[model samples]
Target: MSAKVPASPRFAYKGDRLKPLRAFCQTARLGSISRAAEALFLSQPAVTLQLQALEREFGARLLERSGRRISLTREGQELYELARPLVEGLDGLDGAFRERVRGLDAGELNVAAGSSTILYLLPKIVEAFRATHPEVRLTLHNVTGAGGLDLLRSDAVDLAVGSMLDVPADLSYEPVYRFEPMLITPRNHPLAQKAELELQDLSPYGLILPPQRLTTYRLVDLVFQQNRVPYTVALEVGGWEVIKQYVAMGLGISIVTSICLTEADRERLATRSLARYFPSRSYGVVVRKGKYLSPHARAFTELIRPALFEREDYYANGQSER
Candidate 1:
């Protein structure tokens, strides 16, 4: 009698290799096998076995474990970087295929933006998008910059719309709008009376600024420090509307992006361009480096700015500054 062939090892065949790779990618991303297992709905031992299988298949040690922390080795890092996009693409294939079949007539598009952007910048564009693609389910997530970035990275949102002071390596920012910085004070305040104002002139008046952790506060701090101008904060609060209200009440003067300014605001508060002191803020679309845009997403982005991703070198530069 012929000897029977031994059963093949699990995930040993080329076609079946995706299983191990998926496990490894998830583990690397979470930095913990247990968390990866939880995300993948697999047992910890199973995930560990899959990782081992992947390492063996590639003939390289792919992970280094210390206490509760797990990190990728040099070879693992290189492999993870190369394989992540492929894995992500594969993982999203079903949804992408469905979106393609549905076309722009139907599909969900999630966009993340801050309150100011939702209030001022996106109103017209959003209205236009809804008019064109009323059937598409569009969800707008109002979140801060850091929160928006987190959502973008986690694939919770298809794109983010807002101002970015610094661009990360794994993300691309393409600016579509620019607004000058402005200093606002009560209409009758001393600074508002002058046709021209100096930075030092405002030092005596207390400033109403956002929280210290926000970009606006930091930018204002940086400018004053560089110019050696001493300043004080009269109030720390959130939201441009609240700040403007406080300034109008003569609590203190404030610096704000012109994006939030309106004709009505001018009647209550005297506004002067602070472009010389602060850089103009640019608002745009931010996306993960290798994110695949769906038909609904593409349609919405096009409404914001035509051909937003036509160029292949779009991500080559961190951002296009105007």
Candidate 2:
């Protein structure tokens, strides 16, 4: 006698039954029914049932399970490729429509930015964006430059702003601003009286440098190395704020991006321009290649474009004319 097969659940009609396409796509992409279930907020058995239903509908096994792991078959891979975008598009549409109905100006905007940009640039932009779109939810992930780049690559945030040492081939960058670096020292330091000082002249002072990996640190290093000027590094900190505090306490003099200095920083310490030429560091926006920008993201980018690009042009042309 043939073995009896287990009965599948009966639906009143195909139209009334929820299509398991979404669940099937999730499982195939994630490679685990449990993970798919957690992402979709469904029970593990329910996710399995959905996948089983999908396989039945297609008349072939979509996944092969071994122990606790899963892998898609060839046919499953093709089907998943076709279905993933459709399901993701549907999800995007639903979110867009709900946000629209709530209000044209309402929805969350997530931004990832480095600490220096957060201190110097982000507050003004955030205030302006909020004033214009008060109903919109805004979130910021504060990170170092490398951390922000990692977040962008991992799809953790919609946008990031910071100083990128080099633009990755997989990412796009737009210059937001460029500012020269300045030498910072304690208020009573002897170099404070000079309007500008050469790099060679400061070789004897203890330096508080950004960690060696940072773009700013590399830029400073290149200038000193090329000139064969040796300086003592007394401390290395990751963030500009920490570097500034250390300088204020007389730990060491440091070279910092001018944007990182504020009125208070100047009052508490002293800044002098470098007599030797060093390249200006650029602050900019970075986005993952081919990521779709929502309406709010587009608008925010537009609002910031002038501050990033046009103002610099204005300054450049004005200086030339003068």
What's each prediction's clash count? Answer: 0, 1
- With candidate 2 superimposed using the best TM-score fit, by how many Å does residue 77's alpha carbon deviate from the native? 20
lDDT of 1 at 211: 94
In order of appearance, the predictions have TM-scores of 0.65, 0.65
The TM-score between candidate 1 and the true structure equals 0.65
Per-residue alpha-carbon lDDT of candidate 1 for residues 1-322, written as tens digits (9 for 90 to 100): 9999999565544567777788889999899999999999999998898888788778899999978889999999999999999899999999998876775456778999999989877787888888888887889999997899999999999999999989999999988866777888888888877766789998999999999989999999999999999999999999999999999999999998877876578578877777778888888899999999887787777777642222223211221111
Q: Highest TM-score among the candidates is held by which one? A: 1
Worst 10 residues of 2 by lDDT: 313-322
Clashing pairs in 1: none
Error of 1 at 96 (Å): 11
Clashing pairs in 2: 176-308
Candidate RMSDs in Å, in order, are 13.1, 10.5
Please state the error at residue 219 of candidate 2 in Å: 2.7
What is candidate 2's lDDT per residue for 279-304, written digit by digit as tens? Answer: 77777788999997767777677677
Error of 1 at 224 (Å): 0.3
